[model samples]
Target: MAERIFKYVVLGGGIAGGYAAREFAKQGVKPGELAIISNEAVAPYERPTLSKGYLLPDSPPRLPGFHVCVGSGGERLLPEWYVEKGIELILKTEIVKADLTSKTLTSAAGETFKYQILIIATGSNVIKLSDFGAQGADSKNILYLRDIVDADLLVETIKQKKNGKVVIVGGGYIGLELSAAINLNNLDVTMVYPEPWCMPRLFTAGIAAFYEGYYANKGIKIIKGTVAVAFTADSNGEVKDVKLKDGRTLEADIVVVGVGGRPLTALFKGQVEEEKGGIKTDAFFQTSVSGVYAVGDVATFPMKIYDELRRVEHVDHARKSAEHAVKAIFASELGETIDAYDYLPYFYSRSFNLSWQFYGDNVGDTVLFGDNNPASDKPKFGSYWIKDGKVVGVFLEGGTAEENKAIANVARIQPSVESSDALAKAGLSFACKI
Candidate 1:
């Protein structure tokens, strides 16, 4: 077995890993002290792009263009960026075993690495239909997007099956975004989900109605109240049709399932305290195991704003929590003080020239505003979550930067609302003033 050592090691080269490495470099790390072990062949890039620009038929974002930090308008950390900083980029390396107590990780190739500090940013894995024992799920062209490999394969399949029928299985952001993308490619798109409406986790029925209608206007089919149960593959094992639980069969040239994701915590299971289907961490992103940190989708940490422990799966929290972890590490080393992480849940999605932003918790009674007519030109609308007369969350679609900022502020400050009527009447104007 090969053996190596590093003072700091970031496991999983995703958003949290990349950003954590960047923070470590900023705080100062000597040559040979920092290393990033990743199963991917390339350096970390913006994963959110996989469902968006990367799927675009025209001028898709290429590597180094959408690297981490670039999404947030920071310096793009290309492979050379690590080289220049004397940070080792151990790409295409998968850790097969992790002994947290020993502060060591063994790769699939039997290579072992010891670290003084271990950042567990392993991220997540795509939920496969096979996981549910769906028949014929191994059929070819039955794809799921998670990493660049998955996105690239989808792109190639799109080219091979241009103007073909695409059945997107799932109504969340992935399904919605890919529906728009496949439609833009001049293909027939049909979305499938078991929910009454799309994005039930976030979108209100009112909000979903607009998108459902808008998607219809875009010539995309929305099949709600059902799910894909099995797939029919051709003699070549390529999926040709999708069998639905609701007894509706759809001809599908390509099927993409985006049901959901589970955090990558199996390696640390029983070795770490877990909650909410993720490794539990404090505001500082430090796990129960000393010197073992967690971030990104795998880290369920305290959300001070909500006064409850929350696990944020969005890219914003990934970047922020990674940097915060590094800061906390260095602070402890240098005997300095730092504030606990206080994060406001922020999520956004863009598709078919329409964009939306949401901030804060999405609980409580909702108040919808603006025109939600799917066919209207420049249709703008928003919603507010009111709990005990205070706005707990804000959602705005087709908002200007300034307007989005205003709603974000409302979520941040959580100002009190006198009445729902006044809040509705004021609408965007209400947030603008606040």
Candidate 2:
């Protein structure tokens, strides 16, 4: 077996991996001291664009344009940047086995990798219908977007099946974004979910109502409180019909499932301590095992602001956590100290001339404010979540950059709220003042 060694190695080439590499370079690293190993054939690029701009019908976004850092408004790191920095980019290599005790990683190939310090950023894998024993779940054209390869496949399918019928399974980010993307291709799109509203984990009924109405206006059908139980494929094994639990079958040329995802941590199952379905880490993102750090979707680290341990799967946290982990690593080497990660949970999505941003917890009572009419020419609205007499969360649709920043601050600061009625009446002004 081939053997290689590096002082620092980052696993998984998703958003976290890319951001970690950028941070390592920024913090000063020897040319050959750091290496990133990824099973993806291409270098790490922004994963969010796969569902957003990449699926657009227009001159859609292509790679090299959306590489790391750019998504967060930083300098883009092209494939050549790694070469220039002498940082090894090991692509198309999957590490099948991890031995934390020996500090070694075994790839699917016969190669072995040894590292003094390792960063686990394996990210998450999509939950598939087949995992639930759904019939014909393996049919062709039933795609899930997670990586560049999946995005490319979907793009090609969109071209070949222009104006075709599409059934979106799952009501989360992927379902909403993909429905809009396929609709833009002039395709007939239908969304199916087990929940009564889309993004049930986050979007309240009022917030979902506007989006559902907006989607209806765009001629996208939505089927709520039901799920796809089976998929029927044509002679060529392409999905042709979706059978739902409610005894409804919708004709479909393509099916996309986005139910949810779980962190990729099976390789290190018994090797490290885990929590919240992810590797457990402290404020510094250092796992129980020394010289090992976990970040991004795979790290269930301490959420200082919430005074708890939690795992955030959003892109913003992925970027920030990766940078913070690298900073902590360097600081530890110098026997220095840095502040703990105090993330104020942030999430956002954009589709069909509508964009929204949310920050902080979604729990507690919610107050919807502003214009949310689906048919309105220009609708600007927001909601505030008040918990324990404090504004713990904020969501705003059609917000300017400055307004979005204001809401984010409100979430971080969690200003006091005297009365829900007055807070709703105050609306955007309350956030702006805070």
Candidate 3:
């Protein structure tokens, strides 16, 4: 069996892994000292673009285009970038076993890797219908998106089934975004979910109203309070229809399921401490085991700002946490100290010339503001989550870059409000003034 050694190893080449590699280079690493092991054939690229621009019917983005750092407005890191930095890109290698005590990782190909410090950025896997015993879930053209391979397959199927009837199961980020993406392809799109509204974890009813309305305006059909209980396939073994729990069957040439994701933590399950379905980490992204760190979707780190432990799966946290982990590691080696990670949760999405950004937590009473009319010539709207008379969270749609920054500032500052009605009346001005 082949064996390799490195001063640092980042497992999983996704957004976090790419950003971590960039940080390592920035902090100055010796050639051949660092390596990134990934199961993907390509180096790490922006994963979010998979469900967004990559699915666009016209002039879709292809890789080398949406690579790391570029997603965050920094220099794009191509596969050649790793070659230039002398950082090994162990592509198409899946590590099936990880021994924290031995500081070793074993790949499915029987290769072994040893590292002084390990960054666990394995990220998450999609929740599949087959996991729930949905009949015929394995039928062709029934898809879920989590990685580049999955995205590529979806794109290929979209072409093979042009202008197909698509039944999307789930109303969260992936489902909503995928619906819009498939719709843009001129496909007949219908969304089905168990919840009364979309993005129940984040979007309030008032917030969901605008999107549901807008989707309706775009000719997208939505069936709420129901879910796909099973699937039926044609003789060719391709999914032809979706069977709903509500005794309704919908003709579907294609089906996309995006219920949720589970962090990939099985490799280190018994070797490390885990919480909230992820590896527990300190503010610096250091795991319970020294020399082993976890970031991105697989990390449940302390939220210094909220004074609690939390796992953030978004790309923003992934980028920031990975950078923070590398900086902490370098500081510790130099016998220096750095402040704990103080993260202000941020999330955003874009589709059909519409964009929205949310910052901070999404708890407490919410006040919706601005023109949310889906039919408006220019629909601009926002919502604020107030707790203890202070703004704890803010969501804004159709916000300019400057306006988005202002709302983010408000979320971070959590400015106090005298009255909910007054604050609503003040609207975007309240955030702009702050």
lDDT of each: 0.93, 0.93, 0.94
lDDT tens digits, residues 209-284, model 3?
A: 9999999999999999988999999999999989999999999999999999999999998888899889999989
RMSD of 2: 0.8
Where does candidate 3 stray beyond 4 Å? none
What are the root-mean-square deviations of the candidates from the true structure over C-alphas? 0.8, 0.8, 0.7
Q: 138-247 in candidate 1: lDDT tens per residue?
A: 99999999899998899999999988999999999899999998899999999999999999999999999999999999999999999899999999999999999989
Worst 10 residues of 1 by lDDT: 305-314
* Inter-residue clash pairs, candidate 1: none
RMSD value for candidate 3: 0.7
Q: Considering lDDT, which of the candidate structures 2 and 3 is the better prediction for this target? A: 3
Best by lDDT: 3
RMSD of 1: 0.8
TM-score of each model, in listed order: 0.99, 0.99, 0.99
Clashing residue pair totals per candidate (backbone < 3 A): 0, 0, 0
